[model samples]
Target: MVAVYGGRGPQTSNIQIRSIPSVVRRGENVELLCEVENEPDAAISWQRVDGDLPYGAESYGSILRIPSIQGGGIYMCSATTRQGIFDERFGLVIQEEFKRIVKLFIVNNISHSTSEVGKSK
Candidate 1:
C-alpha cells in the first residue's frame, strides 16, 4: 500500500497529568507529570490552584515535584500552542499518617501477661 502525505494538517491541542496521585501523606513528597499530546513543542506549565507551589519544589519539562505536603492541593497543568491553550486540573488531598497498634498476650503456667506496642493516640 502507498500513502500520500499532506502538509501541516490541523491538530488538536491536549494536555494531561499522567498517573497523578490523588492522595498523599502529610510531610510526604510527590511528583506530578504533565503531558502534552501531539504537540511536543508546546510549552507546559504547572501551578497550584489553592496556593503556591511547595517550598523547594522543582519543575522541568513535564514534571512537577513537591518536596512536601505542606502545599498539597489542586494543581493545574497547562499547555500552550498556536491553536490555543489546553489545561487540566488535578486534586491532591493531604492525609495524616495513621499508626497501627498491636497487642501481645503471653500465658505462663499460672500467670498471664499483656503488652501493647505502638498504640495510637
Candidate 2:
C-alpha cells in the first residue's frame, strides 16, 4: 500500500508594526519593528512604497533600520508563510526643526563705565 501526504506549516494571523512613530525629526535614526501572530512561522521583510529605501537602510528578519532619515514616506512590512502573506503600512512624517538665531547688541557707556546688552531673535 502507498500513502500520499501534504506538508504545510501554520500560517500567520496578522502583521503588526510595533513602536512606529507618526512623526520623526530629520537627521534622526529610525527603527521599525514588524510583528506577526505566529512569529516563528512567518518571514518578514520591509520596503518603501514610494521608492527604494533610503541610503544606508538595513533590513533584518523582523526589523528595518534607516540611518539618519532625511526624507519621509510610506513604508510597508510584509509577512509571508507557507499558507499566505500579510502586510501592514506605516506613514512617517519628517519634521524639519526651525532654528532661531539670536542677535545681540552691546552698548558701552564709557562715562558711566557700564555696558548694556540687548538680545533679539
Candidate 3:
C-alpha cells in the first residue's frame, strides 16, 4: 500500500499595500509597494483606479514607482495565480503649496479686519 498526504491547494491572500506616506508634496516622485501571500508562482500587476495609468509608471516584481505624483487618487495592485486572484488599494494625497499660501493670506486678512473693528469700538 502507498501512503500520500493531501494539503491545501494554492491560494492568494493577505494582499496589502505597504509604507504609504501620510503626506506627499505635489510634483514629487513616490513608490508604492504591494505584497501578497500567495503561491510561489503567482504574478502581480499594478493599475491606477482613479484615472488613466500614469505614463511613467513602472513595476518591478511587487514594487511600483511613479516618476511624478501629479494627482491624488487610488491605485490598485493585483496578484494572480492558477488558484485565484487577489487585489489591494492604496491612496496617494498630493498637497499643493500654492493652496496653503492662499489660505494663509485669507486668514491674515480676516484677523486684521477683526482687530480694526475692535479698535473702532
Number of the predicted model whose TM-score against the real structure is largest: 2
Distance from true position, residue 85, model 3, in Å?
Answer: 0.4
Ranking by lDDT: 2, 1, 3
**Model 1, 41-70: lDDT tens per residue?**
888898888888878888897898877667
How far residue 112's Cα lies from its native spot in candidate 1, in Å, is 17
Residue 88 accuracy (lDDT) in model 2: 89
**Residues 1-121, model 3: lDDT tens digits:** 1122335643325777874584688778888888765455668898889887777889997888888777878889888755567777888888877644444444444434334454653
Backbone clash count for every predicted candidate, in the order shown: 0, 0, 0
**lDDT tens digits, residue span 1-121, model 2:** 1122336543336677875577889999999998876457688889899999999999988999999999999899988765566778888899999999999999996775666679655
Local error of candidate 3 at residue 10 (angstroms): 10
Candidate 2 vs candidate 3: the TM-score winner is 2
Which 10-residue span in candidate 3 carries the lowest summed lDDT? 1-10
